[model samples]
Target: MASRRHPLATFFHLFFRVSAILTYLCCDWFSSSFVGCFVTVLLLLSLDFWSVKNVTGRVLAGLRWWNQIDEDGKSHWIFEARKVPASNMAATEAEARIFWLGLIICPMIWIVFFFSTLFSLKLKWLALVIAGISLQAANLYGYILCKMGGDGDISRVTSSFLPQTVFQTACPDDFQKPGLEGLEIHQH
Candidate 1:
């Protein structure tokens, strides 16, 4: 069977991905003022980050992340994974692939621009290039975490610096209560 995504998920996935590239080009190629272009690209990058992290990610792949502060003022990162198992997660997998692929490609484009500016000694564009790369890297990190089951368990560890938890309250297979075997209820 083929995997499929909701129409909106498909829309936003393409929108955010294409917008990132277009915004970068517009700021770099069309805008006359360096400061103005930098600010515009920064704003667009921020919008992409928020939309991907909050809206499209949840709608398409059912994943999200947030941070919490403890009494000691230490920060803990939490990743929430919807319990859609692999067997039944074909659609989610497809959506995740789109999200991840876009994230990967977007950063590469920025990296190219970064090098082009560096070699040409166009130091004015330095800040904008770095900021774009940083934002894309952050998005990539979240995508990786989502793929790793969001439990901070990418590998076995004997010790850890940060605390993590995986709450599995929404497993699709465990949603129903078991009853007497062979018992059935009928309604009129």
Candidate 2:
């Protein structure tokens, strides 16, 4: 059986996504200053982005991405792919759904806000909302690519990455030593 996310992790994952929307709406009730409202929304949006990328993503989905500067000063993204068994694929899919759904929906809410402010000639608030939309969209793109690349299923890299000893131990019955006969283990 696949391990489930902690209750608190799940709560915060949903909370942060929803709070971003709620904060923007509620800011009006608290103050009339456009700058104050813009800053407040920006802070909440940042919190949502941070929580989704760092806490919820790692805890719920077992996925993470980071950029590293190599010795030659070239930057590259290093992704961590958690080894999940076939049985846990469904759970992983569910987590991915939540993550992607939030990514799609949050920016949409901001888009609506953006146009409303634009039409009203609220340039200051529009600027901040545009920034929020851009940040969310970038996050969405990165996560989608990461999910596609790091899906826990076996691929060309999996065979090369898994050592023969461990593979044999894990699949003793069907194990075939590499470079012997024409046997190849192809996982679907």
Candidate 3:
């Protein structure tokens, strides 16, 4: 049986994502300055990006991703998944569901925000809207690669433009734990 899911990991998986959304939605009530609202939303988005990329996804869903540049100046996106073990993997069904749903849904919300902002001609808000969409969409794309065994091309044009390399990593003994796995995930 899988080890129990870490509640903290589940909490973090939702934390920044929710915080960023709420901050973007309610920033005007709290701060009147455009710069203040922009910076806060961006900071929350950055935190969401970092935490999702480096921490919660691995613990909750056994996935990690990064980009590598070859000596020739070409970029390769690498998506890695933890090898399935003889025993069940650490992620519980609920935890994995939470991770994936949160991963998938947030970007969709941002897309709705994008169109709403565009149609309203809220030109000043467009830059922040784009940033939110890009950051969330990147995670959604990376994790979907891991979930699908990392084989699918992101797109033919993207593949031709940037290239991609996918590999599976050995599941570390303490795969369910959070701290040291960050270093191992980046290892080729």
Candidate 4:
């Protein structure tokens, strides 16, 4: 069965995505906007939001599928030029190259960035490092918040989308609690 969309969650997702991009580009006043965007994207990417739960489920499912593979066989993947179509072979090769390159180069890229930051004596680079550290901290906070549920979010402090109505004041019944001593409610 498919999950029903929560109206509030949908609104926040759209708001966050657009806010993140704007935060990155709106550096006219404060340069910290870029840092905010970095944190937001990192959090959004890592968090298993409803939109991404399928992706997480697929990953877990894929791992389970892989475990079923027979590891005892002496096997090799031989791509026959005659059997496979040229376009498909080319596409497969391109995707394979990308996967292999990501596997090899991502760590190296991080290592290079690490050493460059570590050995650098420049003030500008140090500022960038500080921004990155702030982003990581924000991401960690976001993940913790996600785990705890979205009833409370630090984004509400920075976001303009938070509810600010005085309807509860006008309609007091919505805000009032019933007396538990005399209360007996139907459990439907």
Q: Best candidate per TM-score, number?
A: 3
List the candidate 2 regions with Cα displacement exceeding 4 Å. 1-4, 89-93, 150-188
In candidate 2, list every pair of residues with a backbone clash. Answer: none
For candidate 1, the TM-score is 0.70
Candidate 1 global CA lDDT score: 0.63
Tell me the RMSD of model 1 versus the true structure: 10.8
Estimate, for each residue in 54-146, the C-alpha lDDT of model 3 and write its tens digit.
998877777888888999998877777765443444445446657777876788888898999899998798899899999998887787665
Score each candidate by Cα lDDT: 0.63, 0.63, 0.73, 0.33
lDDT (Cα, tens digit) per residue for candidate 2, span 1-188:
33444657767777766776787777778888877777777787787778877777766655666567889998776555454555555455456446555666678888998998899996767777888798787665555445446333445433543353334334545653222122122111
lDDT of 1 at 52: 79
Q: Once model 1 is optimally superposed onto the true structure by TM-score, how far is the C-alpha of residue 185 displaced, in angstroms?
A: 35
Give every collision pair in model 1.
none
Task: Give the 10-residue window scoring lowest on summed lDDT in candidate 4.
Answer: 58-67
Off by over 4 Å in 3: 1-4, 84-91, 155-188
Error of 3 at 109 (Å): 0.8
Between candidates 2 and 3, the one scoring higher on TM-score is 3
- Supply candidate 3's per-residue lDDT for 179: 29
